[model samples]
Target: MTEQVPVTSEMATPRRRKVFTIGAALIVLLLLLAAGTTFLWSRWTHSISNDAFVDAYLINVSPQVAGDIVEVYVREQQRVEAGQLLALIDPTPYQREVALLEAARDVATAALEKSKSELAFLEEDVPLAIAISERRLQIARDRLAEMESALLMVTRDVENGVRAASFQVEAAKAAVVLSEEDYVRYGALYEDRSATERRFEVATKSFEQARAQLEASRARLGQAEAQRQRVPITEHQRDAARGAVEEAERQVEVARLRRIEVDVKRRAVVEHRRKVTEAERAIELAATEVEYTRIVAPYDGIIARKWRHLGDYAQRGEPLFSMYDPDFVFVTCHLGEDKLDGVAPGNRVSIQLEAYGEPFEGRVLWLGSATGANFSLLPRDLSSGEFTYVIQRVPTRILVDRDERWPLLIPGLSATVRIDHGPGDPQWVEEGLRWEDRAAHLSERARD
Candidate 1:
């Protein structure tokens, strides 16, 4: 070793200053690193998902009627508008069915008309019959009253005549007796010569006249007795008239019951009307079937598949093609459960489509309440045994921005999604990376 010289104060002071500066710089670097790590960790708030796909409403088109395919106006990958005719089934059979149904309807309508006409006739006839029967009943009642009154009058007159005739007969008998007595006295006087012959002759004549009067009175009394006997016959006749009145009343009731037939006919008309309505409905159904021969697009979409061709036999409800509406295209992403705390609807999202190799603007439109595993064919059954916990993922819907200038995004396209959770700009991550690169360079320099 060589002999050492004594150190100066100036040199020692400069060395101390240099050591102090290095220590200060190290402390500053350590503080910067701690601050940078904390800032970066705080800013790492975004949720990323690569398990995403573009989705749309896939529509399955089918024929409503079964028939041979007659015309096909669209093919695979064809763009079509809503209500555009896609194909047509053979309409001959449906047309025939419609014709048959229309004929049946016509027959039903004619039958209904006939029933109505018959009902109308009965409607008039039933009341008219009832009226006639009632009038007959009234006439019978009137006749019965007349007969009764006549019977009463005849009875009274016969009784009074019999009484008068009996009195007359009694007086005539007395007169006859008196006349006979006078005749006998006159005869005696004539025989005895106590009176003249003329006087005796007059007494005889008076006696003969009284005897004749007595005979006439007897005849009138017999006639009066016969008339009194006929009074009971008149009563019997009145009773017969009363019976006639009762019969007439029954006839009126029978006529009223006869209207029930008209009611039955009305019911028949109603039944026929119901049948006609059924026939009309059948016709409507036939017409509907005829209309169903033509298949029309349900919405505006592109035909992704075609399952039938012209001249191919198709059945009802058979799927003919697959299509979808373009207006509702969106991305479906599966997000981790832990990542959902910051993701919500209306948040802006970044979508990277695998097919286009570019990013597109999107938004968080919807989020599923349950994870995809819950909806899978074999869901988790924790109750079966000991379990390994899995951080389930929630399904989220991202609506891609619709821009005609951009490429058309179809359904089922694989896409990556990055959802922005906070208002922090994503560019800041890059800025932080740049800051890290500068810090790393500075550290290397410090090491060197």
Candidate 2:
């Protein structure tokens, strides 16, 4: 058997102390590993960003029409409601314009009515007058026909009277010749003592009677010729009747022309009515301009800025005031691209307003597709020689619950936000999160 070595208490104590020191080092290392694991887990469960601010929709109130401001109703930072009168422009000019337009429209309406009445009168009376003229023309034509027939009958009577008078003249001439022959023969016989004185006297008396009869026949012929010449007078009367018919026809044509003129007047009345309508529209436009002289609030909000005052001249599209709704306030944060890996809308978030000194709860409402710098008025050029790669931050919108306590929290307030990336309570996350929860969290932090 090997020689047994003698052991000392000091050596044994040293060995025991070495084992104890190693055991203590191992325990410390295990504790450090556990702490590192916990820290990493916490980091993985939370996404934090300091680049955020309270934001709201800002409205730039401007005038719809140009005018001098007569009254300003609110001061800077004053609260107002929807439809509240914020300012008033000088409405005297617009009012006067509306009045003038109204008067003009009334005048136009009266003119249109007059034209319509005139047209109606023409419509009613013109046709009747034309009918009467046509009837007159027909009567004139019939008169002409009667006169012409009378002229033909007079002409035939004149011809017959002329023939009868010529036959009487020829018979009287034969009797006168016979009487002269008898008178001469009786005178010769008496001279020869072959006839008596009584016989001779009878022959002379016969010759004288024949001469008187011849004179009567010639007078009758002259009278008959005068009657034949009178036939031309009947022809003259027929011509006069023809002229009357032509005149009547002209009158009828004039009546027809008057009817056409009436139709033209009807068209003129239509045009006047259109003018009246245009005047009415002009009056409406003037009224609208008058109404535009008053500026009213569009929604409930506090005035953030006042750009105009009493006596200020406001122009269209010029800002008179600036305002934002307090109840609609939210946080706009720039989330780093690396932090958006698992982030999405509806993520639970905690907001800490530097002004409020409290944490407020909110939920992600929207996520942007582009970086903030990309939307800047002047974006950085990546191709420049001094270009350096920069991490882009995406803009994220978070909706906060309305809280009466934080009524002063408006746009542009500094804030920090932390979003929970771990499994969240569906009831609180899905249904809604209260900003009051942030007040409670503040209380808890204060207690701690």
Candidate 3:
């Protein structure tokens, strides 16, 4: 303008052409930017974070029991299988415990055998005692019956003797009365010279003889009654029989008590055997652990972490080495909420890494239950003061199936993901920004 130079048509055309090319380039760039907006948008976007990574399952091996580490079977990054050995623990104490349990079991078994033998002896002796008791009881009953019969007979004899004595006493009384009357009459006659003195004396002698016979019969009756009362029931034999029965019953009870004791001892033996078996099982378990000390690859994998080294002291459950299954690798992508539209579980995905420009084909396998920000160790506290809204991300698991084994991809690798939710809605990056509005804002911003 200061030179006031005249502009030729050719020159003007060239300048105009330059501006048009610039504008066209800018428009293309804008379109690209618009498409990229879906990746970071709240809906219908497929933006990937620069912090994306490839993750995989890792086995963190630990011992079930505590012990000093005796040997390690695997190195820092050795692969292992389900039953493969990883390390070994010191087994001396465990082996000793097993031996002790075995000894205890043997002792218990011997005690049980002795108990069985004692039981057998009691079984044999108890029946014999019982039989003896039964015989004695029966004999006692029979003898008691015989004694009762004899007692009755003796009682009858005494009664008869008493009756005989009573009859003699009455006869004696009659004879005395007759003799006295005759004596009195003869004495009076004699005195009157009507009877003889010798007749009086003869009547007196007859009465005295009858009285003596009555005394003798009474003495005999007394002796018989005393003898009957002196007789004992069963002649004292039943006492012995009853004593034998009681002794036999007590012996049987003692045998039963012994039998119960023997059963308890036998149970103790069984318990000991069980303990021995458990100890052996423990030894086997320890031996298995020792076998694991020679850890080997369960499958083809790489060493991810090594927490122990040669000659290092290790306790049980201490991490020694970490291994990863190279073939089981997958990328866990956290897709923004807006980008999750129509993203079904079986939707196809494309994965790209800065390291590798080529894309990998994968499928969506899972969806996370919550957002990463929600699970953060320390979340921002905005509910107390500010109206702060956060964009939440949902994790989507995508499994790469194009390759049978996972490639050189490792866990915590950066990657980008693209999801084709079937001809998605219009991209919104271009909706708000008109060229004229942008120009005005630029002029205002330039002035500031």
Candidate 4:
């Protein structure tokens, strides 16, 4: 091929050494530049923390009622929607309780209705009976008044008749006495021929008539005296009427007492109504228990673990499954305190997960108020004056932006986050622009 030239060892060594020295100097220069750039980029633009991991809200699903598990409808790592059925407990006992309480409620309600009807009837009937008794009492009083008035009239009539009969008897007696004297005188005159036979006969006939009139007057007086007996009879009738009025008043009092019975019945109705209400409450509680038998998901999530199985007995408040919402995931970073000077909420971030090669876009969510060491189980005590100053890290949260590759991020994954708090182009962008310019220059020289 090419022409070959022979050289001495010293000349060859110096030339080789110069080439080697230039190569080493170029490498050293490159390394120093890279180091300086990295230092400047980190100090001026961003804060980095490797102590970061993905976090989410983990929920443990539990049952609210105790029973035997009748069915299990999910498994570990299964995706579920809100209100999806997870499992079922035995509902027969709860159903039976509800049915029993419902029947009791119906019975109590019926009893309440009966009591109400009885109260209504009494409300109408009792007042009517009282009115009837009062009416009877009024009628009896009126009758007594009539009887007393009649008795007074009869007594007056009897007294007047007796007085008139006595006067008539006295007049009749005088007439009899005078007539007898006249008859005797006429008889003597007839014997002495001073009077005729007709005169004597007239005197005797006059005496007979006067005597009969006296007997008739005496019979009238006796009849008038008998009329006094009617007074006692009228008094007896009036007394009987007064007794009737008293009896009617007693009946009215008895009827009014029946109102107490109505009050008692009303109380019974109230008691029955209370029983019905209690039974209804029991039924409602039982129905709620029955609904508790069906275990449904509270939100859309993925089941992380299944703690119970079919036919297993689960107590109240026992864990049935553990799940988490993947859509609400974020990263928690423990950043050194000195590096948080420019870091703040809403700053841009780049996250690199250990499981993936590409970086994810994120934004600063919030910063923790206390360092991680403050939440330790046994925090170091500094009051004893024996202390070593150590750098503390503050917990910071970064919200990852959702993308097509979001599903690959899981909780507890280790990640390295770079939080950009500066307001200019990043170091990588400037370096890329410089390299592009150099490449263009080289291309132009080649073309020339």
Candidate 5:
């Protein structure tokens, strides 16, 4: 309004170009200094590795027994708790096997009980039978002894009777001879009238009496000889009694042998018990197989993949699903061996996930004992006389801190991690600021 100078486009253009050139030069210089400072600060204070990724222990859930999948309780990406039922295999066959084994076990148990009962009866009966046989043998021995004693007495009595009978026969013969002589002399005197008739008659009667006495003595001697024959009969009876005693002794031995049979029966009982035990074990094994038909989650995790569906035939040891624990996610970084200096466990870490905008905090969990090359499938064979030196990378584990957004991160995600190796603020102080607070602070600083 007051004396405005008319500015030409060329003059204004040159002035603005000068200002822009100066500003651009100053910005370039500042960028160079910032780049240098950043490079030096990074080199001195931290180790960096781009060869990194979020990692976790991936589990391939499988069945321990083969069967048809009867039920599916989860889908892919389903979250599950520890011991939650994931699937079920057909349990009919396993249950049937268990029932069959149980029946067999019952039969075996019954047989075992029967064997035990028989053993008990024999234990009592066998000894009693043995005792009876021993008693019978003792009785037979006593009878034999009595018979022998009686035979001995009979033998002595028979010998004495025979001797006495022989003496009586000799005396009767002498008396008969003397009485005949006297009767003959008296008869001759009577016939010649030197004696009376009554005297002759008396002598004849005396001779007859002597002859009767001799006949009686011979009968007694014959009776005594008959008694000698009875001695042999008694001896035969004693021999028979001795035979009975021997037979009874044999019966006692047989009874004792029956005791051995009892031992055999006891062994049989033991065998039956063993069979029963085996059957019980078989039943338990079948029941265990039945339990295997129910597949449960081994731990709290999320199902990453599902391979078997309902009505599918699942083989033993075949994977049914894949899973991983979200809480256990960590970053595995392959750092250059030279960058490992000053890096130790519990060092602070900054992790930037490819799928997330905000960075996460972490701490060093451990350092690997071997280089990546050592675990390569096709390792270099230095024995071929050809070798190349390579800068090896060491694996380092970083345990990510838990936050509300941590569950969004998954395994196998690309990540960039910076591990702080220099002395700095305590971890608690650094972690005190939430991501929102940090972002707000950065915005404020930018405004300043």
Candidate 6:
């Protein structure tokens, strides 16, 4: 019973048959591989790490003008719309400046009106003075003419007296001749004792009387000449006439000057009016600046951060709060250098976020404008000074096109990226991730 019969040869026979069957199965499997060829080919694609969080475009909110924070109308994480006021600044200083400008404008307007009145008075005075001066000058000319006429009359009378004196001299000469002849005849008679001696004496006395009348006529002529010599009554009337003429001329000149002055004053009024207008405009401008101090949302968005509150000092150009537009949010990711090869805008991309299970569809909005080497705080400039040949990563901007289901898509999320190389791929990449299926079905569970 203990002789277990050395059955090693019998065992070897079954083992050989089993080996032959195994080898034949392997040959058939190999022949099937050689006879058939199937490929699961697809389009070239790329992917990026993704998360579903609330997304919004960010902008630093600050006031154009600086002032104390008067009131804050919004809180952190608050939703806002376009033209909605978010904060307010103290407007006291701007109000005072506007008030002062308005007062200055009023003063300028009053001064302009007063200048116009003064110009009007001057215009009236000049014309009146000119008329008065003309009247006075005319009177002087008339008086001068009267004096000339009087002088001419006096000259005529003097000439008449001279002619009468000459006539009397001739008459006296004739009478004296006649008296002498008579005396001679009488004396002859007396000498002949036919006439008396007294008759001869009377004849001689008559001749003497005739000569005296001639001399008296000549003396009257001399008196008339002396009276006519004082013709122009002391050059005062002529001087007065000249003065009146000069006054008339000066008044005319004054009138002209006043006209010019009026024009200048009118121009001055216009200039002041323009200044007043400008001051009023400046007041409006300053008021607008005060309005600008109250921050307003440019579009519907959410507040990402609030750096200041009421009573907090905010400097000019300093960001007091931050906001973003949810309608324009984009996903940003960094791609390795090797992965970035041949990548361009419009390339398809998929992202896996923190909370979301699987990848999401996106289009490459743009490649980073500058390499990562140039965008860092201490950018690696490999061109100089201990150059390194390390792989460089570039940030790619992708626009997510999925429906708004969950609110976990947010900005500033970390991600990993993958790309696809399908069969028969062309060089240029395309936008959006192409999936194994076309339906944009919910894959929250399938992603895991």
Identify the leading candidate in terms of TM-score. 5
Backbone clash pairs for candidate 5 read none
* Stretches of candidate 5 exceeding 4 Å from the true structure: 1-23, 189-206, 423-448
lDDT of 5 by residue, 250-288 (tens): 999999999888999999999999999999899989988
How well does candidate 3 match the true structure in TM-score terms? 0.62
Clashes of each: 0, 0, 21, 0, 0, 14
The residue-level lDDT of candidate 5 at 305 comes to 93
What's the alpha carbon RMSD for model 1?
Answer: 13.1
Per-residue lDDT tens digits for candidate 4, residues 1-448, read 9997878897799899999999999999999999999989887789988999998767778887899999999999899987799999999999999999999999999999999999999999999999999999999999999999989998999999999999889989999999999899999999999999999999999999999999999989999999999999999999999999999999999999999999999999999999999999999999999998988777778898999999999998888998877776788999999898888777789999999999999877678999999999999998999989898999987778889998998999999999998543345445434543654453333222
- Name the TM-score of candidate 1: 0.78
Residue pairs clashing in model 4 are none
For all candidates in order, the CA lDDT equals 0.84, 0.84, 0.63, 0.88, 0.87, 0.67
lDDT of 5 at 214: 90
The number of residue pairs in model 5 that clash at the backbone is 0
Per-model C-alpha RMSD = 13.1, 8.6, 13.6, 12.2, 9.0, 9.3
- What is the Cα-based lDDT of residue 447 in candidate 3? 25
Candidate 6 Cα misplacement greater than 4 A, ranges:
1-56, 120-216, 234-236, 381-385, 417-448
Give TM-scores for every candidate, taking all chains together and pairing residue i with residue i.
Answer: 0.78, 0.76, 0.62, 0.79, 0.86, 0.70
Error of 4 at 402 (Å): 1.0
Candidate 6 local lDDT, 1-448, one digit each (tens)? 5866676887799999999999999999877665543222221243323322323346678777788998999998899987799988887888888888889889988887887787787678766766776676677667667655666776676677777767776787787788778877888898998887788788778867766766776676677566555545424455655666677667666755666776787787788778878988998998887787778876667788998899886777778888766555567666666666556666665666655577666666566766677767997665667865786767666667667643556666555444343232223223233321211221211111
220-289 per-residue lDDT for model 2 (tens digits): 8888889977788998999999999999999999999997889899888988888888988988888887
TM-score of 2: 0.76
lDDT of 1 by residue, 1-448 (tens): 9999989997799899999999999999999999998667644767888899988667678887899999999989899987799999999999999999889889888989999999999999889999999999999999999999999899999999999999999999999999999999999999999988999999999999999999999999999998987788889989999999999999999999988989899998999999989988998998998998989887667898999999999988888888876655678998888788777676788898888866898777668888899789998788879899788888887767767634468788888898888543445345434543653453333222
